[model samples]
Every structure is written in C-alpha cells, then in structure tokens.
Target chain A: MSFLRTAPAFRAGLGMRTIHTSRVAAVQASKQVRAIAADETAGFKYTAENAILKGTVNDAVAVPTPNKAHGSYHWAFERLVSAAIIPATVAAAVASPTAHPIMDGVLGVTILIHSHIGFSACIDDYVDERKFGALGTACRWLLRVGTAGALVGIYEFNTNDIGLTELCEKVWKA
Target chain B: MARRFVQTNSISEMEGLKLLNTQRMNRPVSPHLDIYQPQVTWVLSGLHRITGVAVAGVFYVGALTYLLHPIYPAIDSAHLIEAVHNLPVWFKTSAKVAFALPLTFHSFNGIRHLMWDTGKGLTMKGVYASGYAVMAASVISTIYLAFFV
Candidate 1:
C-alpha cells in the first residue's frame, strides 16, 4: 500500500462513482465477466459487484484496446465474402459443374469460409473466451481443425467424384 | 404528524456503495425491448440463424465424411446418392423438403441481409415488405423444388 487515490470512472459505463484504486489495483481490476448476479452464468460482472469494477470503486474498465483485425476490417471482410457467395451461388446453379470444375471448387471454398465465419460468430457470442475460458478456446480450435479437414475433403471429392452440382442433381433426380 | 408509511435509514458510504452495486446486479439488463420474444420479427431472425446453422452443419458433415472414404473406401458421394435413392418415396419427399426448406429460406433471407448491407430496405415498412416477400418466395420455391422439380 504505497499509494491510495480515487480515480475517475471513465470506463465504468455502469456507474459514475469515483473508484478508489492504486496502480496495482487498476492492473488487477478486470473481474471475470458475468451476466447474471447468480455467478453461474457467463456475462458482465453482476453478483461479484461487491468488489466494484475490479477491487476498487474507480478501477479502469477492462475494454480491449481496438485492433483492426477484429474491428472494422473484420466486418468489411465478412460482408465481402457473403456478397461474393451470392454471385458464386447463382453461377454454380447455372453452369455445368463437370465442365467448369474451377467454379465448383470456388463455390466449395466460399461455402467453407462462410460456414467457418458464421459458426465462429456463434461461438464468440455464446462461449466467449473472455467468459468461458478454456472451453471457448477449445471450441474455436476444434472448428479450425474441422474446417481444414472439410477443405481437404471437398478437394478430394471434387477431384475423384462428380463435382458438387452433379452430386446434388443426381441425388435430387434419384 | 400524519401517519407515515416511509422509513429512512442512514448508512456508511461503503455500505451505500455496496447496496447500490447489488441493486445494479439484480436490475434487468435490458432497456426497451426484451432479449428474446416469439414475435414474427424475432422469430424470422432466429430462423435465419437456425436454418443457416442446419444447412451449413449438413454441408460440413457431408464434406468432412469425404475424408473417411480413403480409410473406409465406401464413404463416398456415390453411396450417398444411392442411399437416398433407395429410401421410400415418402421418406425421400420428406428428406427433400427438409433439405430444400433451409436452403431456400437461408438463401432468401441471406439476400435480404445483403440488401441490408447495401443500406437498402432497412425501414420498418421496407423490412416487413422484404420479409414477407422472402417467406412467400421460399415456401413456393421449396414446394416446387421438393415436389415438382
């Protein structure tokens, strides 16, 4: 306890009270995020509020420093991929898959990336690493592995068997 | 003095802060609208995700199984088509619908989402108009694809 002082609650959107925190306290202020006060659920720090913010009343909020990869650039890239899938889908539907082997592969890769992004969003929202910790980390890595396997599988299927369109048509007509 | 129903008590600053924080915790973490409700707007939005997950899940599973073909030598698309073809007509029809419904719905809703990305059809009236259009188109297309085509 070399120092003691009340700092402004700039990051604490929950309340405006000046939090009492030292430099050390500020560093340790990031409480486990919880949504419900029940402590079992993973979300904003609620029930654990007995220790305001972190361990002090005016501890700095633990908001992540902005990075472009997970910020606007991420949003733009997702939109671009989704938009590209539209034309790819329409073309794949129109063209003969066996004749345009490249088209089939393009569609397959787009679908894979799209599915990966979409499911990753679900995992981020529900089982966020910030809250679920190890479970979330494992789920993310598992998805990556699954995606990689599926990519290779798609390549193998396209090369060995009838491409995606022919398979769908044969199954539909079957 | 008039009969009083209210009571007042004084507490230390720390105690007051703790009380305030506890109350904040119990407070509902919502403002105007509830998080989830079964209305058309919410229901349709939820379906978009559900259908996307279902369709993509199937695709992923199907694609991933291709990797097993090398080991099993039987887990390939040729077997898959034959299996589907061998199923009873009713089962086939049901399976077709099951597969087609999500594909159509997700496709239509996905287009609607793309329209939104372009900053179009975002108003309340526009949203409902586009939503109803997507629903109608999906149902009709699914029926045609499943039964007729």
Candidate 2:
C-alpha cells in the first residue's frame, strides 16, 4: 500500500521534469522560425471562429439515385416465380409423357425467368461496373444473349420434342 | 539524475497527412467473416445463392447440349437416357437424388424468402422454424422424386 501511494508521486516528479524541459525547448524552437514573406501573409486574416466553406461545390452531382422500390419488387417477383415453379415442375414431371402443353409452357417461362434472375444476381456480385468496367459490360451483354438463347431453346424443345420435365423423368428412369 | 531530452521537429502538414493516411490503410477492418457466429439466416441465404447458381448452370448446359443435337446424336434426350440406364443401380439412384435435392431445397427456401419480402417470418424464431421446414421438405421431396416419382 505504501509503495503504491509513493509510485504516483514519483511519476508526477518525472512528468514535471519532462514538462519543464519541453517548455525550455519550445522557447528555443520559437526563435528558429524564419520570417514570413510579405506576400505569404498579404491575404491572410485571423479570426476567432473557424470558417468552413459551405456549398462551394456539389459532391453528389455524379451519384445515381437507386430505385429501392423497383429493386424490392423485382426481388419479390423472382422469389414468387421460383416458388410457383416447384408445383409446376412436380406436376409436369409426374404427368410425364402426356403432360399438358400449357404446363410445359408455364414451366419453360418460369424456369427461364428464375435462371435469368439468379444469373444476374451472380453477375452483379462478381462483375460490377465499379470493379471491372469494360469486362462487366461485356458480361452483362453475354448474359442477355445467353438468356435469349436459352428461352428459344426451351421453347423449341417443348414444341418439337418431349418437354423438359418429361426428359428428366426419362433420364431418371434410365 | 539529470534526464537527457532529445528534441524532435514537428512534421510538415503533407507528411502528417501522409502518415494519417498510412495509419488508416493499416487499420484492421471490422465485421470480418470470422467474427460473426454462423446463423440460419445467412447460412440459408448463402445456400440459396449456391443452389441458384447450380440450377442455372444445369439448365444452361442442358439447353446448350440440346442445341447441339444435330452435330451430336448422343446429346439427344433418348441417348442421354440410354447412357444413364447403363450406369449401376447405386449411381443412378444417387444421381437422381443429388439432382432433385438442390432443386427442392432452393424452391422451398425461395418461398421462405418471398414470405420475408412480404414482411413475414423474419423474427429469429420464425427464421429457424422456416429454415428447418425447408430442409425437411427438401429431404422428403428428394426421396419421393428419386424413389417414387
């Protein structure tokens, strides 16, 4: 207890010594400052209160305002379509060889949309304009073209041959 | 004992600014992946992304293969089915189950996400409940599709 009590006093003495020396050093340093040129101080004004430049330039001019509502709406619709396709897929699979054309068509469209949304989400994550400018643009265009081709291929398969679900069923049985 | 004091000069404004920027650069970032406890919400969300990519990949591959039917007769659905038929029993069953499981999980979890979008099932309890339900449904659906369907 006695040691603890004296420790702070010892620290205080050391601190006082350092402060006294720093004050003397500061006095000597101040004498070393070069005289300011007349032109350097010509337009300088001293004020008690600091002035902050306000509205000197617009910082948000290039920033794009995002549409939150559209984003959420699209997200919700993608989920809805995904959920809806489950039953459609199961029904088509079970009905197999004689599944109705309407069911096949619905499945094709829903699957295409779901895949497109999913692939776009991936592209958004890994291929952002902020990161990979020209490559991102190229990837976005490629996705668009791939989606179109997929839709056409699905349509052709459904119309000209046995539908997708039927083909899966055949594969499973095989 | 006399303490010897070594004097140092003040840093210039630009040098001070550079030092501050370097300090900022060296500071550790927060919310690192290792710091967070893995939870159902993010785990399921990640799985949803993975399954989404898997499903899309399969669809694209299938469509592309189908498009090449003229160039390669073996790429046709009948020929593909024949190839699968030649595989052993275990391989066939496992392949079907593997195919169906991800699709089932993704579909059910997607419904849960839609419910969240509608501002439902977002509480911790609700998230866990729905996550378990999706897993259960995926297992059941995969079984039925692989064995019965």
Candidate 3:
C-alpha cells in the first residue's frame, strides 16, 4: 500500500533511481567475470588469442584455470616433457628426408626378384598360349599372364642399376 | 592251379603294402612350434618383430626430424651443442640411447642377412644359435656405445 500510494512524481523518481542503481551494480559485476573480454574468455574457452577478442563489454576478464585434478606440479611436468620431445622430433626429420639409399638398394633387389618371377610367369603363359588356341578362354588367360610378366621385366630392366651378374650374386646370396 | 598261384602272390603283396602305411611314410620329422618347448628362438622371433617395428618407427621419426631441420635452423650444430649443454644429464643420456638404437639394429640385422646369404644358418639349430648371438651383440653394443661414448 505504501508503494502504491506514493505520488506519481515520487514513484517515477524512485523507478528511475532503481534502474540507475541496478545498472551501476551490473556494470560493476560485469567488470569482474562478466564475459566482457574475449581475452579473458579465451583463457577459459579457447586459445590465448581467441579469448582476448571474445570477452563482453561488461564482462570481467579471467584466464583459463587448469582442472582441479592436475594441481600445479602436473602442468609443470607437462611443459618440461614438451620442451624435450619437440626438438629431437624436429631434428630426426631433417637427417633423412626419405629412406636411405642403402635401404632403397635393398628394395631394388626385391623388385628385381619380383621382376624375374614375373618374367618366368610370362614365359609360362606364352608357352601355354602356343600349345592352346589363340581365341579360347584359356589361351586368352595365358596371353594376359605373359604380357604382365613381360611388362614387369621391362620395368625391372629400366630401374635396375645392378648388372645381371650382380643380380645373380645377390639372389644367390639371398 | 594258375589262379591259386596268383592269389598267393596278391596276399603277400598286400602284407608288404600294410607295412608301408602312408602316414608312416609321409609324416614330418622336424619339430614344429606346437611340439617343441618354447626357447630362445621364440624370444628371438618376438624381438625381430619388435625391432622391425622399432626400425620403421625410428625411420618415421627420423623423416620428420629431417623435414623440420631446415625450417628450424635453430637445431644446427652450434644450437644443438648449446641445447645439449643446457639439457639435464638424464636427457643427454636418453639422447645417446636413442642415437645408438638404429645403428645397433642395422648392424645386427646386416650380419643376420649376411649369414642367411651364406646359407649356413637355415637349419633350426643354426637359426636359434645365430638369433641368440644377434640379440646379445645388439644389446651389448648398444649399451657400450650409448653409455661410454
């Protein structure tokens, strides 16, 4: 009844005063953790750069806090480990961009072996094709087989730096 | 009379055939993984798989290192030496161990491949024997080089 009975001017004045007071209080609260500063929010939500831009005009800025479980020491240890691993990881990348040529040579030998096997397969197919008719399904299969083998042989011939003699030696040794 | 003679021969041959059963003739003689007790060979085989994986992993890391080395020139000799000096003793030791691992694997594996080439260690006995030697050599050389030098 007291609020309702107040004079119109008085009520209007009180209403204005209440609005001002509440706004001031809100402004003050916003200055602390009001999500006003993106940087502050970034500490909580995003990377350092992102948080800085995302905070609200009325928000108070706060940095991210680690989970309660980690405590102080765990964070410190994580940083220490990162410092150690990041460098060596970088160095090893430089020494050999690809497999060492020595390893490649081994692989090359493997290719040569496969090529020879392919060549034999081709010869088998050719012989089979000759024995059978050219149009028959079995003869067609033989032709395809021989062609694959020949192609492999040609590829091996192109890539192989090792001479036939060396190839023989290596294969025998294997 | 002729039928009787034939019958006698057929019966004798059947007896001879029973003596030469297929299972007896075709059965494998050598030890299989199932029959033999596990030994150094098994351990060595496990180690081979592990080392193979490690070698591949080492290569991957090595590749990444090489890629980054150019971008980050800070890893150059003077910087690296400085970094080494700055590192704790434990880290330095770890670096030494890491450095030796690939070298030791390559060396031991090379020798193994060489033995295989000579066709001397293809038998099971020879395989187990050489596997032990390779394992021992790899471990000893790795430790000696890592810790001492």
Please estimate how well model 2 matches the true structure, expressed as its whole-model Cα lDDT.
0.73
CAPRI grade, predicted model 1? acceptable
Error of 1 at B149 (Å): 1.5
lDDT of 3 by residue, B1-149 (tens): 44443433444322433333322335355554567676776655555545544553443333234334446755333443455567777776676677566546644754575557557688988887777788778778878866665
Q: Give the TM-score of candidate 2.
A: 0.69
Residue pairs of candidate 1 with colliding backbone atoms: A19-A57, A19-A58, A33-A43, A34-A43, A34-A44, A35-A43, A35-A44
Off by over 4 Å in 2: A1-63, A66-73, A90-99, B1-35
Model 2 error, position A116 (Å) = 0.8
Q: For residue B148, give model 3's deviation from the true position in Å.
A: 1.9
Those runs of model 3 whose alpha carbons end farther than 4 Å from true positions after fitting are A1-174, B1-38, B69-71, B75-77, B98-102
Question: Which of 1 and 2 is ahead in DockQ?
Answer: 1
Off by over 4 Å in 1: A1-57, B1-37
Report the lDDT of model 1 for residue A75. 89
Question: How would you class the docking of model 3?
Answer: incorrect
lDDT of 1 by residue, B55-149 (tens): 99998998998888889988877888889889999989998899999999999998899899899988999998998999999999999999997
Decreasing TM-score order of the candidates: 1, 2, 3
Q: What is the TM-score of each candidate against the true structure?
A: 0.75, 0.69, 0.32
